[model samples]
Target: MISFSVDFWYAGIGAALIALSLLAFLLSKRLLKKLLAFNIMGSGVFLMMVGMAQTQNDGAADAVPQALVLTGIVVAVSATALALVVIRRFALASVVAALAAENKAAENDAAENDAAEKNGAERTGSDTAVSDTTVTDTALTDPNLNKNGDPQ
Candidate 1:
C-alpha cells in the first residue's frame, strides 16, 4: 500500500492545473487568452516536476529539477513577450490598412464631386448662350411643322 504524502498532494494539484489549462487553451478564441492558458500549463508542469524531485528520497531536495524549472520560466517569459509583440504588430498593421482604405475612398468621393460640379457649370454656361434660332411650344405641338420647326 502506498502512503499519501505532501508530494502526492502537490502532484494532484499540478495535474488538475494542467488539465484546466489545456481546456482553456482549446476553447479560447483570443490569442492573448491562449497565451495565458499556455503560461498556466507551464506552471503546472513545473509544479509537477518539483513534486517529483522532492519524492526522490532521504528528504534531500534535488538541484537539477529546480534549475530546469528556473530555466523553463525564463524561456516562457521570453516567448510570452515575443507573442505579445507579434500581436501588437498585427493589430497596428490592420489599423493602418483600414485607415488607408478610408482615406482613398474619401479622395475618390471628393474627386467625383469636383467633376460633377465642373460638368454642371459647363451645362449652365451652354444653356445661357444666345442662338440664331428659337422654336415656340406651338410649333412643337403642331404636326404640320417640319423636323426643323418650320411649316411643312
Candidate 2:
C-alpha cells in the first residue's frame, strides 16, 4: 500500500505549476503573457519551498521558509510593477516611433510635390518640360551615413 501526505500533494502540485508556467513563458510571445507566466512560476517556487519545509519538519511549519516566502512575495510584487512600467514605456515608444516615421513620409511626399510643381512652372515656356518622376537616393538621405558619406 502506497500513501501520500498532504505535503507530498502540495509539492507535486507546485512542481506541475512550475512546469506549466515555464512552458507558457517559453511559448508566449507577448510581454503581458510572459509576465503572468513569470508570476505563476514564482508562486510555484514559493509553494514548493513551503511544502518541502513542512514535510521535512514532520508536518510542522517552519519560520525560515515562511519568512523567505514572505520576502519573496514582496520582491515579486515590486518587480512585477517595475516590469509593467517598462512594458508600457516600450509599447508607447514603439507607437511614437511608428507615428514619427509616418509623419516623416508624409512630409517627404509633400516636399516632392512642391518641388515638382516649382520645376513644372519654371519649365512651362521651355520645349522640354521636366519629367514628373522623382528618384530618391536612400544612401544620400540615410541618417546613419558617416562624414565620408559611407554607411556607418
Q: What TM-score, over all chains together, does every model reach? A: 0.65, 0.70
Candidate 1: where is the Cα deviation over 4 Å? 1-4, 109-152
Per-candidate local distance difference test: 0.64, 0.66
Q: What TM-score does candidate 1 get on C-alpha atoms?
A: 0.65
Q: Which of the numbered candidates is closest to the native, going by highest TM-score?
A: 2
Task: Give the Å shift of residue 13 in candidate 2.
Answer: 0.6
lDDT of 2 by residue, 40-80 (tens): 99999999999988988887878999999999999999999
What does the lDDT read for residue 140 in candidate 1? 27
RMSD in Å for model 2: 13.3
- By lDDT, the best candidate is 2
